[model samples]
Target: MSEFTNPGFEARFTLAQAETTPPEVLAKLAIDTHAKIRRAVALNPSTPIKSLLRLGKEFPNEIIENPIFFLLLLEDPESQFVRLSLARSTTTDEAKLIQLFEENDPDIRCAIAQNPNAPLSLLVRFVQESYQRYDDGSGTTEKVNRILRGFVQNPDTVASILEELAYLSDPELTQAVLQHPNVSETAIAIIQAMRGQRGIPSAILDQLVNHQHHYVRYVILAHPDLAPEHLLKLAEDTELYWDLLDRRETLPTLVIDRIAEKTFQILMSPAPALHAAEMIVLWIARHRNTSIALLQAFASNQPDYLYQHWGEQQFQNFRAAVARNSSTPTFVLRKLSRDLKAEVRDTAKTALRSRKLSES
Candidate 1:
């Protein structure tokens, strides 16, 4: 009962919890009779490496959860023990997980993928790497697939990540994602639709037509067999409009019209348009399928304010893009041939000559 035999346990615990406590004191407390006090020392950010190593044996989880543990890893990044411990711990913070992932150790990355707390961004990266490996017939295909399977099995995996995994077209991974309880109905429908040799069925297309998920709608839009009506319906979503304009596949004439109409409206609005809107207009001008009428509109359409605000170089760039479009009519090209910008005038004259040569 004496003070030496039984120090005030609560006071000792308080001392163990203080950041200002000396490292030597923490090292002593690391082996204190009270388990809770030792645990506190283990969790303390200020815990010295020697004491932490000892406590890690007794409380490995606590040691890995400590902020000092991450700092230790930073100092000794090649330490297998620290790297594996941090990678395997669900309590590891995103910053530490990012660092561990960069080590590019296959085993470490696999552990991070399996960790439920891994950030979605990291999970997406794993999926992309795995897809590349799978495509190239690389020797690490099996290991990367293991990483991807861990990603799909992780409870934190979202529908977007699942969609990305499904796109890998790996039969095993796709099946696992489809069967996963976390997969949404929208994701399931899209996955099933994508697997078919035939185009999206009307019934499923109807269900997904208004789906809120952008990836699902993007998949639907990318399907070569998608009907023109569905394509136009999806086009109404302003969020997808930018992506729609960038599609490499020839879009329906009506869809192109919709894009042209919307771009004009946004440019003509009283408020200033976003730089993204201008990019969309440029894409429309460059689209090979753009109708003559829309090309004519773009050829002549110049907002004085846009020219003034965007500066002469950018304005000339838009005209140059229009002049480069093969779909631009002869009359529009002739007009562009006289453009003040040398680049636009040269581009327009070249296109006009090409058209005449083809006709001859």
Candidate 2:
């Protein structure tokens, strides 16, 4: 004000405005913009995820009903916040959805089945409810495909829903569920679930071995529960097993070495590819010690390896066995502590420190 050129005046003015914002006023203003809501809720998730869900629920019906909006936030940079936010929105009963399920109109049933943010419990409940009403005339198959749309969009969560369903199901439904077309992400979840339920038909495992989707086939191949026949089949699916090299991060440790070997083979084939060489190094870094040993024998001539894989964030929401007890003494803890990727290293260290402090 003195010279109309005070360098820090704008900064001071902004701070004063922020300070003057009443708690209620600021909360209201924070709710006005989705991006601002994201920032506010991220700063204060301890408050509740529903703070932003209120914003989503305020939208016009058309906007609320748009699958693309859900899809957008599914991959949104602020998606984790939005997901937590919407996760608390009210849940409707299968009763509300049942009539829609019976409607001859596929779109209505599609809508009934495909609400992107529906809870897993709701999905499983509706599947059962819809099946009860179906009786060969209820059009359950069409609804299954509609539900599958949700499964494909967010496979990780839907997989858990499917797993929970698998546990609570009779053999017929469980059998059909495993063979569902979107078996990509659900295979591992279902297998992990069957540990207690013991109802997953062996046929599902066999079908998983030859499943069309790459993810389904790879997960089943990596299963410790796999019988010798499954292993023998994978060993013979030479071309298919080699294809797993394309996505080694999702592959479990059991087959990671095989995938590494295949990548090396593809790299050295008569026509060499640079991507293959680079990816082999990245795969080696992920599975680390054991795969590193295999890589040395597989790619002795490969140049100095500097892998730039960043997956720690996507992995945060999924429950890993290593995360169950929150202990840090395990081998994974040591490997992750030294992970070259900054995100992986930081999250691992944070998790270990939190676990130590909690145990203390």
Candidate 3:
């Protein structure tokens, strides 16, 4: 037989690739002199974790791509070695990254933030979580800062995400973003111009709001000391409306009315609105801080056509959310108790009952 058809090589390759091969045999094959056989063992789903680890230094890519490696992660979710390897792997899927993110281990999340394969939505979520953790005093400032820095330094980080981070106004992170190769010159100029200003002057803020780039306007809107009039002005810009609604702790009653009106208009419009817009309306209805007037408005505004198009159950679900709001007025609860939908009526009744018990 020719050297190319060597039986020993073929036999080793078969054993390395076979799922039914014993772990000990795979472990032995992991060190095979032939690179192909060793690669096959690394790629084999049935390869023992110990053998995979042994082969990891030599064949890191093959080991990371192996299904068994992810299984090992599932088996030991806290294993730093496994989590870091998967987090740093460019081949790691978005779904897996998201799952790893849910673990809320800061280091793992930081790794994912910096990973090129991480989805944009997940990166946005990481930024939001980092901000929340920092605000709530739940996370150490050092760790939160590190996570933010990781997102800033990631090559895949987009302008929108950079905009959100810029809103934080962290000097160090701003510097990192300025230096990032992926960041545009315009963005760098904007950041440079805004840098070291203790509080943005009204004139400067006005100029920023009208600047061609939405990112410049976003930075102005996110300013810690942004004036109420400026906020109201920015709210008129539909592009920034959702961000304003999501980021602000308190909004003027007029702004809230505008949001409510827009929501109803979209639902009634001939064309479908983005699902995200509808979710914002839902969030407004369910938030405890939502104006009592708006909750009552949502509870009482039962348009027949809305029920017809949105489905009676779906329409009732929105009313039910309003009923669940702690700030919902008792009169509104009484009104909802008579709602045609049982869910709406039941939720309103429960809230009313809970109130009476609390008073007693």
Candidate 4:
């Protein structure tokens, strides 16, 4: 029997696994059979611009599904796809995000508010609009509040915006701000004061402690004026356990033990490949009190998956995340300091300096 190896065989095999194949290989596979292979090439971050453009003409859905390609589509300024995708992307550029905010499509505008990367100015504007429409006698208040809730949950929403929302007499709106991850201590204090001498009511605190957003729950757990009963209730929540451990220094001994046990259980569980989980692993790696056992667990799970799998723009983002991580090992920084991307190298050097200063 003849060997199954041929140049065409290699091309077909590599294109079949285009998700991990190199860009040069993907460039060759871009013109391969119509549906699956070309779609794979379109989704591959390393696919060349020419390949993407060719695919765009024939397979716009494939282009739309590829986030990097979607952003490039946005550059056209005339494509309706740009407006639609920009509405959903949390990573679109600030200027384009601003432009999307002004688009005539209210649905698209609402989507921009939902984007995690949406600017604080836009969020503040939405919150203000919600407040203004609260008593306008029209039915717009509920819709405006629904839209502003997205802004409230965004980490980018500034403390000033949260503070402003806290002053509003609407209990639901104020409660939403209190659950924000970025809500300042000063804003919490203002909210606490608004509730009168008895303290934030159990119902509101209960709801805030159970907020779906981890960062929001973290903020609530970190609040100095938090009610003792609320803290105990929050400590019992398995979902908030990591955030609780992340603030170990402030937690009571019993709470710390619970958090540690919960964290260890999660560590022993099968790890997921989700980006959010990977980020949490990196964060736990940075904590000063994280155990050697946990560090060993993370050694194989370093956030460098991005560097291995992503194209230029996404790789730079991964490098930036590593640079910002204070606990990123020195060896990693040394390697990153020589990265071809100037931003990556500069950020690495800056992080190294910060690490040195902190050590001293």
Candidate 5:
């Protein structure tokens, strides 16, 4: 094998064999031992988790019951490259991997807890158990939050499980996950999990709108039974511009009870119907052949909100509508022209000037 092909091959294989071997092989295995790991961290810090991941699929049950993986991150040469290589590992090595991760040093356990690819069941157990371990109640909430962020990134976990975390009364964990970088669509599950449940208030849901993740915003919008306040926030979160744009057409007509109330309320809520109207107007500006029904829906829902907006294109649009269809009432044109928004008033004036010219 070319030397390039075998980068760190010996260490990888050595790490691999320790996971699979009998007690006899495990001891003889030339791995840098736990003491070695602790000492290494004095110079270079990293998660000391080599033993559990090295075994691949055949890790011994003994190793599973008591993992040696956590010690690796404690060492200086924290080459988690070997560990991260095993991130999505399907190796039947779970028992040993988790045993060490769950039972060992807090730092090792945390590395596992933070891992995006750690087994969901093991991660959840670790998260829950670690919370209890911090019994002094000192700052355990922060610990739980760290685990929630890990799970938030993995989309495949059970919804019920994610919701369980939502039920945790720690405002810190709930709010932390709401804003976590790895957080995305999971906020929807968290919100739904909060349904009718007593602990979380509606304000936290509003905070999700400020998240950089639009998919999380989109998920909040996808909820049919969202609170009026939360719906208002999502409907108006400028960060959700693309989300509303993509789902605008279907949302208005998507089958829901009390269709008018939901649609109208979503469009007129206090947060800023401007988000909904502006996005649609922007879309209409791009695709003039847009379905008139959807366009008309906006016309009916938030025309007042439209006049309040600060964009020139919005006014230009009202003017263009007048020119395109003569039946457009003159009074509607007059209201838009007399509008206080200078850009809008200017555009409306230009439209009236053009209309009078053509008629003459």
Candidate 6:
């Protein structure tokens, strides 16, 4: 028979949430008719391994998504499936992760290496394994290479691993390592030197600019030795411009000027929806070196188009933003200072005072 006679979902859910719920009852509730009850039981720390394992199989996503449950499932010896699921989970611990890596199965190691939480130890091991089995590069070697590629792509892979991978004689592997977000400045210098010796073409620079990995592109932008020409090139690339805007403060004056020119056009364009215009304005207003003319023009013309395009709250926010802009023209500030809403008026007055003090 069932543990609770015709129990409602609420009662089972409440029982599952109780820490003191007996192991037997927890086990029974894990298999309860309602998924909500099972969800609560999967979260409970005191739930027995058997019950948790059962939940892992029956409701794999629930077990995989919860760090607490996934870590416990990793420790279960009876279910390789459950353990493999933990290996794939982001929250799996380092010790179980190391154990998973040590196994002979390439698929298991690859799965672990792909996990964002794969610790440095696993990454180091994966890198070391990549160099081994150099015999004509058969099945295991190919799989290991794939695992190494996954490590290069994983954001959490350590900088040290990336630096070490930069020295590989294999050009493709070296290129992949360079594309990693964690690749250090020193490693980049070494790779550039190597590229010079190897006669690698300048087309690689264009490829790096368009790298699918945003962080990799960011690393290229932030490279200390990056040339003004390259920075300008990246700034002009439509795909990389937004990323350029994100780092606008630290960018060279020339690069920032170029970006501002493009962004101003986007802000002035009537074809793109008002939301896009507002986003550009926000970027311009928030960033350094925004043109005074741009701010004043937006402050003046935005209200008419903005009110028509924005909802009531959004329009209010736009007005408040205009009030806060120090670059907003004095006439616009004075107009906002007398606005009907007290909040908008107060913000304008404060900005006006600050602007006057700075001018003095």
Most lDDT-accurate candidate: 1
TM-score of each: 0.49, 0.26, 0.43, 0.32, 0.32, 0.38
lDDT of 3 by residue, 117-162 (tens): 7788878777766546544546436766876887676786778687
Location of the lowest summed lDDT over 10 successive residues in candidate 1: 131-140
| Local distance difference test, each candidate | 0.74, 0.44, 0.72, 0.60, 0.46, 0.64
Give, for candidate 4, the lowest lDDT window spanning 10 residues: 294-303
Cα lDDT tens digits for candidate 5, 168-274: 44565566555544444555446444443333445555554443344445545544444655544565555454555465443332221123234344556666443
Q: What clash count goes with each model? A: 0, 0, 0, 0, 17, 0
Candidate order by decreasing lDDT: 1, 3, 6, 4, 5, 2
Per-residue lDDT, model 2, residue 196, is 33
Across 104-161, the per-residue lDDT of candidate 6 in tens digits comes to 5666776776676778777766665654543224324666666666667767677888
TM-score, cand. 2: 0.26
**Over the stretch 94-208, how does candidate 2's per-residue lDDT look in tens digits?**
4544533444444443444455545455566554554344333444464464465345345355454565344322445555556665554455455443443344467777766
Instruction: Answer with 4 or 5, whichever has the higher lDDT.
Output: 4
What lDDT is obtained when candidate 4 is compared to the true structure? 0.60
RMSD for each of the candidates: 12.5, 22.2, 15.0, 25.0, 15.1, 17.6
Please, what are the lDDT tens digits per residue for candidate 4 over residues 1-360?
Answer: 122233465566565455666566677677876567777777776777667666654554566678675466657756555565555665568898787777646656666666667787876665555444433534345555676665576676778888757645557767888888888876675577555434555665666566544434555676555665666678666656556656545545444444444544454456623324334444454554444443333333333443334335654655555655555677777777887878878988998998889899
Task: Provide the global lDDT of candidate 1 against the true structure.
Answer: 0.74
Question: Compared to the true structure, candidate 3 yields what TM-score?
Answer: 0.43
